[model samples]
Target: MQLVLTVLEIVSPVFILALIGFGWVKAGHEYRIEFVTRLAMTLSIPALIFVALVNAKIEPAALTSLLMAATVGFAAVTAVAFVAVKVFKLEIRTYLAPLIFGNTGNLGLPLAYFAFGDEGLSYAVVVFAVMALWSFTFGVYVTAGGGHPGKVIKEPLVGATLLGGLFLWQGWTLPTFAMNTLDLLGQIAIPVMLITLGVAMARLQVNSMGRAVALSLGKVILCAGIAAVVGQWFDLAPVPFAVLVVQLATPVAVTSYMLAEKYGAQAQEVAGLVVASTFLSVIYLPVLLGLLL
Candidate 1:
């Protein structure tokens, strides 16, 4: 009973903020998702990443280890997702990337911060950066069924990610005033992202509940199992290992649905995934956190 409350204490704020966004949208308020998302991804998130990385107290070697673990873990997830789609005779273009790329940024970051503290959030950002890079490159290609994978170069978030890594590696620090300002901007990221997530979900329309439910369940099991295995294989430290598992086990990204819409690859089906997987996460994430805690 005490444990349940502990877990609840950690997880409640995230879901509550999201619920506010969800409720806001359902209440017929104007959200302007595209504008809010643009602000978050381009300005706020990059600032958050830069400040977190530059100010992070983690050792460089530990970051490298976690970085490599995330790289290999993503590769493994991609390979497994591909095989699953092929064996099931599902549409590779539609199912592959969504299965492989989870919502590491929006959901994963805040969860890690709450459950494990600042050190955990620092580690979580490394994994998020890796996943973002891959998702921008290969995830795009898979969804588009053949597009330029080099488009990651044009992303501001990607630039911030690389810049942050460089700072972390070089043991550099910004001036105090500048750092504090960036920290303040960065502070806006998590709560805004949580609310945005709810707003986005409220706007999503799921068309195929059956397939969505099944695939959502499959994603939870496959991602969590694979992350757990790889985290052990790499012998990750306690916080990083739990962060890896939880981040990888996040729900299908709303970006997947947007990609499907853009690429003409069954938008409604991916919407089903976004909805089902997110709904699943409300239950799934807490259980995972309980174990990790």
Candidate 2:
């Protein structure tokens, strides 16, 4: 059907870019993931967020509604994840954060753009900003037992979100040349992020495949369900509603595995979740997009 092809067209480039990174690593090429991640986070992604919000054509009220809906959806996810962790007697430090926070940045953003175009990117960034804020603050606390709140403000993503929101509120625009330059920098974010995702997956060692698969499946279902309910509850427009579901339903972030490693909370298990969830996304995302479209 035309819908199936539409979903494939939207999803193909994302996975292909990721596969390129995966293949690059398998070919024994050197990729300094940390350096690339720093570049994207510190420069490119911020530019993308700022530019997207500044230029978005949608009304601020709709975006505000989406923002609140995303926050509530995340909160609901955190609550359910906590209950599931307790009921299952899983390790709180390791499983909880991964279950609560999905990969809204790298995977979610590009998918939104492809599926719903620039306006979707605008909506997606709001969700990403919410995720970034929550993950940096509460997610870090969950894994590390405590974290510096001030450090969240220091993040470039946070700065961009705040600055972008300010501009959106005030109807401010940067000079044309500056906007073009930022737009050019912003363009690198998606391809690089997709490739980095593939590279990370290629390098990750998944332990406990069964548990990882189960958790990943559970996460997708729970997140998508919550997002769907929240989007309807908030009366989101069609595009924003669909974008919300996709962003929240993204796989476990590679950052979750890194955090687990840094905090000594079953890093290999977290790695397993990351790998399992990402692979599962390749199958389920297209199907989900088909239904959403």
Candidate 3:
């Protein structure tokens, strides 16, 4: 009973904020999703990443181990997802990337912050960064057939991650006023993202519920299982291990649907994935958190 409430406390805000966006969109209001997403990705999210990394209290060695774990974990997921795609005779370009890459940014960060506090957020950002790097490069390649990996350098999030890592390594700190301003910008990321998630959910048009559900279930199991095994192999501490599993097990990213649309690889099918996976997360995340806690 106490555990249920604890899990509720952690996840309620996330769902509620998403619900607000869902409701807002349903009420005939307008939301410029592209604009908001651009703003968050280009500005606020980078600030958040930079600030989180710069101020993280984790040791260099622990973070290094976590990085190795995350890299190996994602690689394992990719291999497994590829096999599943081929076995099911699914469209490789349409399904593989989405299965391999979860919604680590939109859903993972806030859950980590709420569930484990600052320390969790710190660890969460590392995993998020790793996923982002992979998603921008290999994930894009798989989805689009060919992509400019060099263009990844121009991404604000990538820049922030690199800069933040430099600062973290050098033991650098920003001035009080500067840090405060960046922190303020970082603070805008979570609520906006949550509401945006809800808005996206309300607007998504699912094409096939059965396939989506089955695929989503497979993705969650594969990702979480691989992450758990990798975390254990790396001897990660409890919180980082949990963070790794949760991040890897997040719902299919909305970006996956967007990428499918952009690449002409069956947008509606990917939309089904985004919606079905997100809905699945609403049930599984809380249950997973209950056990993890």
* Predicted structure with the largest TM-score when compared to the true one: 2
* TM-score computed on alpha carbons, candidate 1: 0.98
Q: Output the TM-score of candidate 2.
A: 0.99
lDDT of 2 at 2: 86
Per-residue C-alpha lDDT of model 2 across residues 1-293, encoded as one tens digit per residue: 88888899999999999999999999999999999999999999999999999998888999999999999999999999999999999999999999988898989999999999999999999999999989998999999999777889999988998899889889999999999999999999999999999999999987679999999999999999999999999999999999999999999999999999998899999999999999999999999999888
TM-score of each: 0.98, 0.99, 0.98
Residues 31-52 of candidate 3: C-alpha lDDT, one tens digit per residue? 9999999999999999999999
Model 1 residue 60 lDDT score: 89
Off by over 4 Å in 1: none
Q: What is the C-alpha lDDT of each candidate?
A: 0.91, 0.95, 0.92
lDDT of each residue in 123-174, candidate 1, tens digit only: 9999998998898888878888777767888787789888998998999889
Worst 10 residues of 2 by lDDT: 144-153
Which is better, 1 or 3, measured by TM-score?
Answer: 3
